[model samples]
Target chain A: MMLRNTSNAVYRVAYESVSKLSRKLNAAKNIDELSSVFDQYLKYLFNFNALRVHIVVGSDHYYFVFPLKDENETEFWENEVLNFEEGLLENGVPICQNLNAEQANSLIGDDVQNPVLWGWNFQYEDYCAVTSLIADENNQFSSKETEILGLVVDLFTLKYYELITKAQLVEKNKLLEEAVDIIKQKNNWINQIISDQQNVIDERTKQLRYQNEQLMQLSVLNAHQVREPLSRVMGLLDLISFVEGDEFEEEILPKMKESAKDLDEALQVVINKSIEEIVNVFDINSDKM
Target chain B: MNRGSNVLKVLLVDDQKITNFINLKVFEMVSVENQTIDYTDPEIAFRELDNHNPDIIFLDLMMPRLNGWEFLDRMKSQKIELPVVILSSSTSPEDFSRAEQYNNVLDYFTKPLQRDDIEKLLAKL
Candidate 1:
């Protein structure tokens, strides 16, 4: 009866030693941070020499050891199990046993006296975990401590699930932001292509309008300027037979020759204008291309 | 006039004076006894239309200041219904079709006017 009273008194003192739990847990970003949080608080919550926990979340197995050699150390691996963890996770039942000679020698050291080990397997909706706490005769873990161990395990495991879910949500949000950036870049590229095509179409329409005006000018030159002198030549040619000798020589022939020369000059002018028009149009087209 | 008391009075209008010379020569070759009044300036011809009192008129299509169509339009507005023969250098189908719309256009001929063509006109008169 005295041993129970002393154990209860020790637990009360440990609980009072712990200051803030939620503040520490809120600052935690990863499981490594949570590991430090648990390390600081676990000793105060329970009486144990060593604590080990193994949790399986998705395909990853998280294993941690308490009473860390360095407070700043943070390293966790997947699927790395110890010999003691195998027995702890062996069955659905709870274990409270005194370590045999060989087992005690391997876990602690051969020098340590009678060490007792306690293990429990916890089942949750998404995952399963196992935790073990070791004690010795100097620190007596009676049936009362065993009952308190259940409550402590429950609280730790619930906090661990919250931290894992928060981490996964952050990973998914980062991926979403990257996808939105790519879509914005693609939209800008499409707008640039559309504006470039519009500029090309406008330039082509301008060239076509200029060429059309040149063609109209050429047609008017062909109809009026070219045909005017040509008609005079035809008319004088027929007058050749109408007159007598000196009148034909001085009057008719000279007039016909002059009309023919006028026709030739008109044709030359038209030809020069056509060449100039063609060169100007070609220049307008090639400069852009 | 060879046919006495029925004198053929011809009015010739052309922008080119050289073209007018050729038409007048053709009229003389035809031996048609006619009193001819000719003008290189079409506006002069349009002003002297009632004074000339021509039985038949020869008109050129293309001209400076006043073209054949504009002269004809003015003549219609003045209500001068003289027989007119279009003597143009143009052989365009559109020009021929357009001349058909003028009420007093008796014939359309491309220049220079031949002796045979003058005979046909005198026969028509």
Candidate 2:
């Protein structure tokens, strides 16, 4: 939004008024100084209402945060701020003449929608200085005020912007510090969880290794035991086969077949046991790996 | 009406009258065990706190005259240790953490008060 040429005269007058107000505001050291400055500023800026200004000042800005004075005073201030916008500009043209306080409500009236034209925002950034014209109903630049208000506003804004920038930097620094602390906290917590999980893993690995050793010993022992049984069954089968022939064609042949069956059963048991042992080792090793 | 030792006195603080009304109804119908006194004005609520040692307090955050955070600050400065339960529609994580930071807070519950939630919460009490 650049400054227009139409509102040169009015912009200077408004800027002068604002300069006076700003000087008073800057000079104010205490409540008394503030009150005096605010009184003059309100009178010059808003002549429509009857009010006495009492406001609270903070480090960066003024807070209407809590009303420190009589409740009636607030109503008066609102009335002035609202009605000023409802009034006319230098031109005969009405910003929103058809609007009424009861029906349209000043809050939603011409000032809010188009403040620059109505001179309602005389204290607004640009208008506060004398560098810009108050825009018209069509938002055209003021033929009377021009860019004087804009210049003053720019100057003041630069100062205020610098302060705001510093504040923002401080806030950002605080946020960065907080983020760092949170990251540190999360890192510590994750480390703790990892350590706990590692301990459990170590304990489980030790138990599994011991169990694997025991199973290996059992497999070797069981293999030896199966071999002894198989050898006994084989010897019996051989003796029967040798005696069977013609003399034992009936009873001797039946005994030889029974011995062979026992030997086959023993060999099958040994093969099954070996497979089971191999599978157990594979499962344990796969899980650990 | 009858009075007993189990009959508890509770304080309800919020700027919104509708919220206070709904909370009161819920308290009468759903609260397992407690009596209540409701106040819309935060300043008045603080005064009521001083006068009445209520069993529990249900507080809201945003207010016109005095905000909930300000009320809490005052209470803390004054060393007023009443078990406060934050009853707010705001589910901001910062608000939750802030409530936790204070020792006076007993619990935090979001809006649209549920019957089962209140029952379980009261059962613990």
Candidate 3:
């Protein structure tokens, strides 16, 4: 009757411990948060002295050790654990255990009394996470206790995968935001260039209109000024034709010479004005540049 | 009238002496038996209007003392009835349009005047 009552109490404790651990694991948001939760509760839940979690994603191996009392012991355990993982990988097994007190003492050290090493190799897709639990002799794990520990480890592995996936999503969102900012800056730069070019084009168009007006004025001036002298020459020639032979030398010759000189002077004025306008236009263009 | 019975009395007013000389020679070439009087000063020409009693007056537009428009204004105030023709170096449309506004302005001619222009004036006279 006492044995039956003790067994009932143990079953109830195990059920409550697993339910609490499962709740904590589900609530974990990140790797750091999950690691903290495991560190705080694993000893109380399974009575283990040390806990080691090894997560492998691609070529990278992440080691998470708990209650690391001695640095030297941690280093030694890490080498041993790596060797054990390698052996498991070679054999293509998912779990390995060394529960003998004598073998555990010889392999690990005297610090642990009756150490029971439990290791698991978990794979989800291409990624693998291997975990090991070590118990001291004073709180040596029974088969029932180790089964509960296994359930805890399984929960931790699933939570870890969830945390890693969430971290990757956050990184991708940050990169996408940076890319959007760069594209906006480039568009603003291109708009500024287009506006500058439009200003130059507008200025050139205004200058061309002014030049056209000046050319039209010049043409009108030429028609009036040049025609005056030409008309005088034509009239003088008509007079020369009408006059008798001797009368031409005395009367028409002097007037003809004067009219020809006037025509030459008028032509010179037009040429000078045109050259001045051309030079002014060139100077205006050079200044713009 | 002083030169002959059928001869016309012609008055020529220009600021340039060379222009007056050319017009006088053109009149002689056309074989017009007329009494021609030339004046370089517009004021002198206005003063001689009564004495000459010219049948026709050829006037220049641009001058130092008095421009053609101002001369015409004076002529209008004085009630002068002589047939005046504009003989100018300017072919501006504004000048032509302004000349048309005067009642006594018989014609507008851009110099140097052709024989055809002189002949037309003579025919009108």
**Best-performing candidate as measured by DockQ:** 1
> Between prediction 1 and prediction 2, which has the larger TM-score?
1
- Supply the TM-score for candidate 3: 0.56
For candidate 2, write residues A1-289 as lDDT tens digits.
2445545665576768878767755555444445444544543432222221211122223222112243433333342323333232223233322224442223233332332422222244322211111222343333332234333334344444444456679999999999999999999999999999999899788867877776765554443333333333333343443343564566434544554565477567667766777787678778768
Per-residue lDDT of candidate 3, residues B8-115 (tens digit): 788999876667877887878665677888999999999999998888889988777998899999999989878899998777787899999999999999988776
Which ranges of candidate 1 are over 4 A from the true structure? A1-33, A68-79, A84-97, A108-113, A138-158, A186-209, A231-259, A277-289, B1-125
Superposed model 3: Cα runs more than 4 Å off: A1-15, A68-72, A76-81, A94-109, A142-150, A203-209, A223-269, A284-289, B1-125
> Which candidate has the highest lDDT of all?
3
**DockQ values, each candidate:** 0.27, 0.00, 0.22
Q: What local distance difference test score does each model get?
A: 0.75, 0.55, 0.76
Is 1 or 2 the stronger prediction by lDDT?
Answer: 1
Model 2 chain A is weakest, by summed lDDT over 10 consecutive residues, at A48-57
Worst lDDT run of 10 residues, candidate 3 chain A, spans A68-77
Native interface contacts kept by each candidate, as a fraction: 0.26, 0.00, 0.32
